[model samples]
Target: MDIPAPAPNGVQLHAPGVAALREAAVGLETAFLAEMLKSAGLGQHRESLGGGPGEGQFHSFLVRAQAEQIARSGGIGLAEILFQSLMEARK
Candidate 1:
């Protein structure tokens, strides 16, 4: 997902983008923010989890995965990939 880091010079964000690029990007941001707002509503589904089983299992899994990845790269690069992909797909 990391397109080769650009040259030493800063790469303009729209360098490889379309002719009406700003309009496209604005539409994408609108959809992205809406999706984020929709996801914010899912917090109500939280049922009290018992301490016996499935307590933070998937959450712990991701924590460990991210930890391992961070150990490799010294930071959460994968999370950046996830966020950027989510935003870019907004359109």
Candidate 2:
């Protein structure tokens, strides 16, 4: 499942696919965190606060960004474990 990209300037690597794998793992973590945040009602719009249709529509974007940040910050350590597992499996 790992595909190696071409190297340039005589530079080569025996494990060039780790980056893609790591990215995929992180992305999965981010999505999971986003859904978790959504379920936790972190982005819920309050009518008393004058939140309306627009806020409801864009609140998800805010939640997604916050989730991405959390994931990037070692969120629940899922991403790291997933990356390691994927790397080992590929090997």
Candidate 3:
């Protein structure tokens, strides 16, 4: 779970753990969207989760769901790992 240094493109690489978090986010988002579509009885999919491009209260819900996935994958130490890095950077 080593966080990579910020890159030239202003993209800071995540820790290996963060990558896992991102994957969890994607998976959870997918599952959640499926459930929503099913529950709503759209039967296939919505034109979009919100209205148009970038509208997703539903998406935010998925992000929160992913947090649980991360906890499951990384355990409580994921918080420690992130907090430790934050503390170090503050110094």
What TM-score would each prediction reach against the true structure? 0.26, 0.80, 0.32
Clash pairs, candidate 1, are none
Candidate 2: residue 64 lDDT (0-100): 90
Residues 1-91, model 2: lDDT tens digits: 2322343334333568867776787788989999999999998998988866788899889989998888777788787778767766776
Q: Residue-pair clashes per candidate, as listed?
A: 0, 0, 0
All candidates: CA RMSD in angstroms? 12.0, 6.9, 12.6
Candidate 3 deviation (Cα RMSD): 12.6
Q: Assess each prediction's global lDDT (C-alpha) against the native.
A: 0.39, 0.76, 0.46
Off by over 4 Å in 3: 1-12, 44-91
Order the numbered candidates by TM-score, best leading: 2, 3, 1
Clashes of 1: 0
**The candidate that achieves the highest TM-score relative to the unseen native structure:** 2
* CA deviation > 4 Å runs, candidate 2: 1-14
Q: Which segments of model 1 are wrong by more than 4 Å?
A: 1-19, 42-91
